[model samples]
Target: MTPNALLLAHDKPAALRPDQLRQFQELGYLVLPGFLDRDLVARMRHEVDRWVDDGLRARSIDSVKDPEKFGVPPVMELELPAHGELITWSPLLEILDQLVGAPYAFHHLHSDRQAPDIPGKPWHHDYEHSTQTDRSATMIHALHYLDGLSTDTSSLVVLPGSHRERVDKTARAHLGTEPLPGEVVLEELPPGSTVVLHSALFHARRPRPGVLGKPRYFVDASYCEVGPLWPPVKPYWRYMLRRARELNLAPDRSELFTELTFAEYSRPA
Candidate 1:
């Protein structure tokens, strides 16, 4: 697909066009510029500020790194009202239903306000298959850029069609965030844009060094196509799902928070 074709306006259509679905299936990612409502985006941005300023984000990280001591986080990103709504945003789910093409379970949600000087991330994918086996089933990450991308912000660089390769998540880490052939650099987007990615697609965050611009508000959520017992990334993943269920985050979608979708939680070696 052409670079311009990669981006679709956020019309919240009843169903995605056949070509849009085909774009995601073929190129392994779809850019939905201004996918979220401005009001919702504002609310989410407020919550993100509270999440960071209140030390909740650090606590959540601590819980993950030392679950034995920290246990479940005092609050999860989904617990925030705006974030909860975002998790079950009907239009987003409808698109996921089309892309995933089957019942899927909520994998995880993360919120952050990245500093202007945040370092670039090496190329990697977040696909979670327990044994690094086949990619028969689909998994996706909805990357929500609340404040959106700009020359001042770190740009997202994705290697098109990389999900088809059955490789490790960091197979291209040696390349750092350097430009590569066939890479798509997403640098400009309006506020509230979202990029849905095939979980195995190789992507990286390319930060512009020495420019102290505004903080980037980002929230990402992932879902796994039901069938295989996928591995849970967080140690308190059960608690996370339970909270989502209790909060009725997916009242209409019963399969969204069911623990049956996961095998067991295991820390990475």
Candidate 2:
């Protein structure tokens, strides 16, 4: 498919088209420009400011890094009303249902307000398989660019079809954020754009040096197809899942926050 084919316009139908599904299956990523409504974006941005400004983001990270010391976070990203809405947004869930093509479980959610001068991230993937054996099941990351991409902010560079390779997440880290032959640079998306990626697809953040840029409001949430027991990333993952269920984030989606979908939490070596 052509580069343009990878992106679906905001005004398009909420349901995933057969060709769009095929593109995701083949290319391992799909860009949804302006996928979110303006009102929702405004609310999420407000919550992001509160999340960062109030030190909630830091506390959440601390809990993950040193769970015994910090214990459970005072608040989770999903606890924020707007964030909860975004995570279980019906239209988005419907698309996920089509893409995963089976029952799936919520994996994790991260929210951030990145500085303009933040350094570029080396190429890496975030797929989680306890044994790292195969890619038989589907796992996806929904990268929500709340304020969207522009020349001021860093671009998202993704290597098409890389998920098919069964290598470590950092297999291409040595290459840093340098351009590669087949890499696609996404830098000009409108506000509230979202890019859904196959969790194993290699990607990087390419920052533009020497330019004054605005803060990039980003929120990413992942979900996995539910046949195998997936590894939980955070130490307090059980509590997080429990809180999500208590909040009824997705009342109609029964498997979304069930504890049976995950194995015990384990820190990375």
Candidate 3:
């Protein structure tokens, strides 16, 4: 899609209300059922299939492991046409801008299709902090369920208000993917649903047993509020941002691709 067309997607985003903002601040997450555009979601699924099947996804991972050897990937996820469009999809960015309450930088984007029997991922958080210090700024992960959730598919389980606890991302790892008290099991949503999460919020993926459901097309892209120099997860983050700029994903927001928004890349402990 053209840059002008991408901007139009932002024109009719559901308004973010004061109460919703308060809920996010207090609850640590918000569920926008069927928030993503249908056409965009369909295109994203195509890119996702190609990303996994064409070996680009594996190549991207290999580069991250040994940057000195692999260097920048031959192709990045955002380099994919639909993936690029999704990153700057206007409505999504508007919600992000409101939640962050300041300029933010694109952190990373991950795309994958889970098999029906894929094992449940253990409880964890994606907040990137080497020191595991206080939550001074905001970082969010937009978890997109292209096919949505159902009884047969794996479900997202999250602990409400977990972001308030200043614990390491793995504080709850020992708990595994088992259900917990006060947890919310998100099992049903429409095709283009998105669950926007505080990166610090604890969440898990629980797969259904004895039910081999359809493949789950999942893509998550994250952004960090601009304040402190945020750490970059990918060794080739510079290349990633440069590609986004080359593609003009966010033509109006220079900060989205600015190098100054990030600290030097470090191998996480």
Candidate 4:
């Protein structure tokens, strides 16, 4: 409806709320521009460049013009000790949990890039890997753009909450398949703002690719709960560690669960 109503998507559980979270279910995507600090953007861009150069030198590659096509594809793992200081400890994920009202874990980053003047990629849900149907099943994508991303240079096309529908084989084709039957919304965010979406929402990318070798850059990570953190739906267990170190829940979040991790949760699975 209004940008003011849209900003509330982040401040939920009390102060602010995401009217769009519900809207995304029906529309497929949302956008918030100029929502991040310039310094954070600069630091992220620098880290990305350093990671790319390191990969090139290590692999002795002449050029890495099309990493977004697929595979491990040379993306920087922002969690590495080297890049951790750049911007890891943001409380965004915790707030994200409150928004989704579910437990989720950090998924991988795409280390994405697209060449000059390329069309949008195939339309698909970001949760391409997971097969679970827990309504708690959702993904939060925090995309930080670098190098002046715009509607002309590039923008994300979403089918607004298309996650509810089953995957269409036609749209899964390699020829940059089209969006399903729904309105196409474009996200023209500034350099540092984040794009958060559910795991099921259908979204596509249109890359303008300014120069020949240059491409757009964005980072994505997903979150899941600790209860369903492991497989076979095993009881989530942990040791006497008072703190949760990414792999397990924090003591504050799961005190009894943490204590019962080894004793109770760790059954057969």
List, in order, the clash count of every candidate structure.
0, 0, 0, 21
TM-score of model 1 (CA atoms): 0.96
TM-scores for every predicted model? 0.96, 0.96, 0.94, 0.63
Residue 167 lDDT, candidate 3, scale 0-100: 83
What does candidate 3 score on TM?
Answer: 0.94
| Residue-by-residue lDDT tens digits, candidate 4, 1-269 | 22421442323332224564566555544455544546666766666666655663232122122223322223234434323432233445444655566544443344444444766667666543334355444555655565546555556666654667655423444646454575464545555556666656666676654444346666555444444443211111121122224433332444222332222332221
Give the per-residue lDDT digits (tens) of candidate 3, residues 1-269: 11111112224655677877888898888887777888899999999999989999999999999888988888899999999998998888888988999999999999998888999998999888766677889999999999988877899998878988888888999988999998888888778888899999999999899996889999999999887888899998888898899999899999998899889998854
User: Relative to the unseen true structure, what is the C-alpha lDDT of residue 3 in candidate 4, on a scale of 0 to 100?
Assistant: 42
The C-alpha lDDT values of all candidates are 0.91, 0.90, 0.86, 0.47
Q: Compared with the true structure, what per-residue lDDT tens digits does model 1 show for residues 1-269? A: 23643454456464778888888888999888888988999999999999999999999999999999999888999999999999999878988999999999999999999999999999999999845669999999999999989988999999989999888987899999999999999999889988999999999999998887889999999999999999998999888898999998887899999999898888878
lDDT value for candidate 1? 0.91
What's the TM for model 4? 0.63
**What's the ranking of the predictions by lDDT, best on top?**
1, 2, 3, 4
Model 2's lDDT to the true fold? 0.90
Spell out the clash pairs found in candidate 3. none
Worst 10 residues of 4 by lDDT: 232-241
Per-model root-mean-square deviation over C-alphas: 1.5, 1.6, 5.1, 8.2
